[model samples]
Target chain A: MGLLAYGDTGWGDELFFATLMTIAVALVAIFIGFFLAAIFASFKLSSIRILNLFGSFYTTVFRGVPELLVIYLFFFGSSGAVMYVAKIFGYDGYIEVNAFFTGALSIGIISGAYSTEVFRGAVQSINKGQFEASKVLGLKKKVYYYKIIIPQMLRLALPNISNVWQITLKDTSLISVTGLVEIMRQSYIAAGSTRDPLFFYSFAAVLYLFLTFLSMKLFNNLEKHYSRGY
Target chain B: MELMIESFPRLLNATILTIELTLLSLFFGIFVGAFFAVLRTSKIKIFQVISYYYSYIFRGTPLLVQIFIIYFGLGQVEWLRESFLWVVFKEPYSCAIIAFTLNTGAYTSEIFRSAFETIQKGLIEAADGLGLNKLHIFFKIKLPLAIKQSLPAYGNEMILMLKGTSLASTVTLLDLTGVAKHIISTTFKPVEVFIVAGSIYLLMTFIIHNFIKILEKKLDYSK
Candidate 1:
């Protein structure tokens, strides 16, 4: 409809850009989750009791709490901590937590908890003999991980990673509470200003479904590509 | 820590609301989910198709969008406003319940369907051999076995639903997260307020987690 047209009067361009922002935030969070997941998964897999406890504790706290609370902590709560540190450094001013940073970080932490479980499961599923054979071949630790272990872990973890991606993508909607101009926020704004909630929300729903469908196809292809040999 | 104790009552009050919302919606979700699960696996093509699309649309989108559509979108319709449905959709609490019920129902239906499928064909055949009616067989055998088999997965779903109820706060419902945000706004102490609130949620979920573990063990023992 004309209401969704491009340029200033219409919200078409705004919606398109919001969709991109959603994808951008999700990708950033997903990458952050992958890094955190690696560390936590290692801690979980470690022999040390303290390390295992820390890993379990991290996942339990993050996974058990509501995602909204997590976001609120990062958005509103972090500013207090940030200000205290800034005051210590003698650069005290009203420091604000940016929407993108808060949104991505909170979701990233939540996603990392799930990713930790997924990666741990993948590591546990790998054959111990593979590690033994790699050592027998005189492969260094780095090469063992990269050449022998990482690929297999990736193949096994791909399906779960895809699930995490879907979760991360959908969770981006919650970031709208922080005033991020993502798809949900944009639709909300347009709906309010135009007084057409039904139209704008349906449009937003369609956009989300489109994103989900595309991601599903992409992950399916990745699964096929990674699982080529087995 | 001191602030957390002082604010405990407020947080506990909100926790009660959160628990109420979760239990009520989950109560509705289970029945709707079960019905849809049956429909999904039924011989009727139309029922299966309806079930398929219901799950597809609800599962594909985020609960936030669904909430918005129901609250903001549906609330806009003049006919809906004039109809008897207005009683349910007019208030934020009921709207939240409806959204949570439908969303959880979609996910739970899938869980139930998988659980039903896992019910061995031989058990159903044996029940049939005993000359049990379809309804009797489903009620006596398939339903119990499917639920028992699905208990662990259903526990995860319950946790998810508990967390999902936080979304109600966005719609102006004063649940746990909603109350926490309110306290933070008034007290200007986001960290303390949120810590208290988050801990309450963590505690509740921990209890549920352990409860489910005990249930799983008991079920395993009896089997």
Candidate 2:
């Protein structure tokens, strides 16, 4: 098969599928990360000292360590942990967390640490007077967040969070070590199977470039919308 | 505890590899990054656009992806396989250094570019009024000031690079995290190994933070 030929004769098919998995993992991780970050950010913002300390510990430990270490940590025991939880639910059969969930969870958690910082910074940037103003107007917390804080926070946090999202996308490739069939893993597999590491790997790199290009466009548009002149 | 005692030498050995990769790549990356920063802000639109696009692709993408594409991507082609560059590309260590250097370069260049713009116009005018040429002003005044201004950002970047060095494990380089993973595979203690590795990284990060802080103080004293 020719180097660039499709129809499973070359690296083309594998590279394309890998690209899809990469995007899928990135989306999954980012969503989970955003949710977890919001929780931690709120926790950090709360009045309780212990809760704030816990938040501090969470960010310190995760953010301080390397992403690869986190991945290896989770990958080694994630399946066992999942199975243990499953056993409590009256399911005895083996319930393993395959590479996808393992990768997603690790990246999601790592990205969450970063997202927490971004979110905390954004929320903090808003003047306390605004909240005070909202309270004077008899606005509920939920209503205030929805109508005022969330919108403004999005504007403040969009660039930083978008950058974290990009970090998440790239970190997904690290899970190839866990034997995940994501883009990088797929490329690695094709490289080994075809003994043509250079071509397949280069093709996968292009897929990443494509995704990065797409997301940059999204962030720029979002920035424009939140921009003062616009 | 006993296991750690036995593993200390091995772990220490791996630490050397980790440090070598981190320091070498960072030094080289900063050089490349500074170059790109100049290119990015140069008057020529093509230079500006090219540097911008380079940063766009690199900074926008994850380091792991870039590493993978380079490591596996280069191996996929027959032509590259035939090329002399295969000697270096075939090795995991060389490929990792290349990847880390390129990725850090993209980010640090952005730091430089921002710091460059932040140099006060008045500062430039004052230097000009002193009869200093562009080259003299840049080297004697601008560069030093930019370094001081950008140190905190570079501090963060250094810690990131420190952590990012762990990614070299994926390429089979057996750095700290790689050794951790290896130890866990044998000892069946994932959490312990990770905790140990994590602490080491934290120590490294703290060292970098202190180093940058010291540099700032020194720069302050000089002024």
Candidate 3:
């Protein structure tokens, strides 16, 4: 119990802070992923064959590879890429791509792949008549998208989005490998330093379950709100 | 590129280990999952609750945490170290198999449970009326139908397990990801090494995905 005491003597404070960081990274990655998914979904839905091919290829590659490898590639490769660009501009000292960026970018790319699938299904499910009616009304593409398509797309996609959110949240643990001080990493540090592996890990597991439970409830509520009219 | 060529042999061996780990754990997971699925779908309330909590806890948390708990948490227990269970639990390799098996078992059981539920009651009643033994009915009718119904989802599970095997690298197993990390550290060529590693995984998954699709098509009697 003393091991879980607050402040420097224990890991209570660090674990709490790390839990917050986990949530932060997951939120940022999810937003980045959701944004990219919109583009990918649109590509899949586009009239051009090449765009559809590109979209499928992106999802296939990301979905096939392990998330850990993706994190490693981003963590290790980002610096070299950054340095090459820096040299081209004649500006170089040391540009470390922080673990946060690496973690978020890699998982964001992964989450984007899955979200693309979900979004494509959601977009395809929307009534074609809605689009035709909007076109007949002489509504601009932007207006129709915002007024009709976006709202309905989101309502339909909420269930899947919530599923992806859980996946993203759980995936934040992989970020621990990149040396980010997230919940998993913090617990590892405390466990290693204190030589109390069981307690710390069990604590970390509980923390994760707690986080998952809370997010599930939150998503369920959002799902209810979106499903109100239907 | 030259360094990657030199490392190909080593990477191939690592890939073999990853495949072995995935398949071995998958074998155990399937059996365990099937048993739990029976429990979950059984008439006994206690069995259902036990199966429910097993799947719930395993599925709710991340696999990484589960791996850590098994590897680190179990190691801390002195009684476990002294027990015969240590033969399996003491080694990182065995610990990993146990973790992956249990984790996949939970997910697979849910898949199996749903697949079982989808089997029409009429089919079972017809089998019962034919005077077939329960064992024969389960083997000829229930199992085949459930498996055919569950193949697509099980294919997804296979891919997940393939990806999940990479986590074994965290426990110091020389699986593909672990070997990739090692080569990256020694060669200072993370980009090329990881790209190769990632491509190998992509190829394997692609093969399995297509293979599963072929099997699904072959089993599609309705079509």
TM-score against native, each model: 0.97, 0.91, 0.97
Reproduced native contacts, each prediction: 0.79, 0.74, 0.76
Candidate 2 local lDDT, B65-172, one digit each (tens): 677777766666678889999998889899999999999999999999999999999989999999999999999989998998999999999889989988888788
Q: Is candidate 2 or candidate 3 better by DockQ?
A: 3
Off by over 4 Å in 1: B221-223
The TM-score of candidate 1's chain A against the true chain A comes to 0.98
Q: What is the TM-score of chain B in candidate 3?
A: 0.96
Error of 1 at B120 (Å): 2.4
- Docking level of model 2: medium
What does the lDDT come to for candidate 2?
0.85
TM-score of 1: 0.97
The global C-alpha lDDT for each of the candidates, from Candidate 1 onward, is 0.92, 0.85, 0.92
Query: Model 2 off-target regions past 4 Å?
Result: A1-7, A10-13, A83-95, A228-230, B1-9, B68-87, B221-223
For residue B52, give model 2's deviation from the true position in Å.
2.9
Model with the higher DockQ, candidate 1 or 2? 1
Question: Judged by lDDT against the true structure, how good is candidate 3?
Answer: 0.92
Question: Which window of ten consecutive residues has the lowest lDDT sum in model 2 chain A?
Answer: A1-10
Measured over all alpha carbons after superposition, the RMSD of each candidate to the real structure, in angstroms, is 1.5, 2.8, 1.5
Instruction: Write model 1 residue lDDT over B47-89, tens digit each, in one string.
Output: 9999999998888889999999998899889999999999988
Residue pair clashes in candidate 3: none
